[model samples]
Target: MSISHRQTASGRPLRVAPAWVGAATPVAGSPADHHPLPVRDAVWIWSVRRFARLALWALPASAVLYGWFTLGVHVPPGPLPIALLAGWLAAVSLIALAGLLAGSRTRRIALTGLLITLAGATLLLPLAALPEESAAARVALAPGQVHTLVEAACAVSGAGVLLLGWAVFRSKLVNPADGVLLMLAAMTLGAGSYGVKPVPTVGALLLLAAGMGLAWTGGRLLPRA
Candidate 1:
């Protein structure tokens, strides 16, 4: 006798889905194909990638060293300060160049001019300080003159910081928080240069913060495969 298939009390067929039914279904596409963040320009992003981390770290370290020096702490005098300043300036220059590449034409011009002014001022700093070392120095400038020169350097450098900060913010190349930190650092430093009491300490704190922001931003810009 022929037997019919077994059925449940609900009158449903007692059967399994065929294995071929699953095979016939289309596979879902990979999630990786749709990246949340789109890739930016390789040239501008990667150009600074290798050295950005180093610059980020060194900039903060140098700021700390200089801050201690400014505080008249256990820091040694002479070439140590000069060396730190040189290294700090070099790192800043690299960062500025990266910003310039990613910045608008107006910002590029402003940053470039400020950097040039800073370079010239830095070169003349030692010469400007000579009057303090030797009372009878042949190439001595008046105390007022020396002060003016130093203040000018500080002001110009601060302007460079401001421009770079604005550029980074405007370009949106890094995290928005990073741009805010950069701008704060620049403002603090600029304000401190005006002989404001206790402003230097605030500037030092902001400088450290900006360095951290830079490092974080650099990490975000690293290339992915």
Candidate 2:
């Protein structure tokens, strides 16, 4: 996302608000906090909700990645997937950043765009599963076209996941653990790209494994209320 700062008439910082404040406000106190804190509860609740969405997304994403490796999926002999994924991220981030510029009133619109982007991306999996949709037909590469697609996509996803994480962290939209769920996102990316490097594939699998572990921990720790 683009860096934003308010400027005075003189061009110095105008002092609008810190990166930490956003949609959710701090309620006085909760049973969870021994001492009252403003946004702590809201933050955790938002995180759990976000995590649930991703975990749902991950199931199909995993299947798609697996097909990308062992199935008939192909990679572009050229550099399309990486570019495409990066482009998608850039576009999404731009919209989100624009919302940030508009202030609290426009935040919902910005967030809606982001969610749309994610929803669109998730839909790609089922379509990609089809023989016609596979990258194999698009560009004929060496041997492992599908694998290459996965790896490149993963790298792009890691970049995106990290950025989303930062967005959430700074916005105080969710807890740190929520960001941990995004780790699944990174591996989801890696799985797409894993075929490029065997070791990296292992690492990607490890990341997915770790993500599941963290998700489990999150479920245990998250408040039922």
Q: Taking the tens digit of each residue's C-alpha lDDT, what string does model 1 give over 1-225?
A: 432234434554333221111112223464433322212333334454445555556656766765665565654476456545744563564454354333333446445645754674565466545555452254366655665666666676667667666666665445557556766776776666575656776776776777666666665553323
Best by lDDT: 1
TM-score quality measure for candidate 1: 0.61
Which ten residues in a row are the worst by lDDT in model 1? Answer: 16-25
Q: Which tens-of-lDDT digit does each residue in 111-220 have in candidate 2?
A: 55355445544544433443534556555543355555544544554554445444543443334454454444545544544345454445435434434443454334
Candidate 1: residue 158 lDDT (0-100): 69
lDDT of 1 at 181: 71
- Cα lDDT of all candidates, in order? 0.54, 0.42
The number of the candidate with the highest TM-score is 1
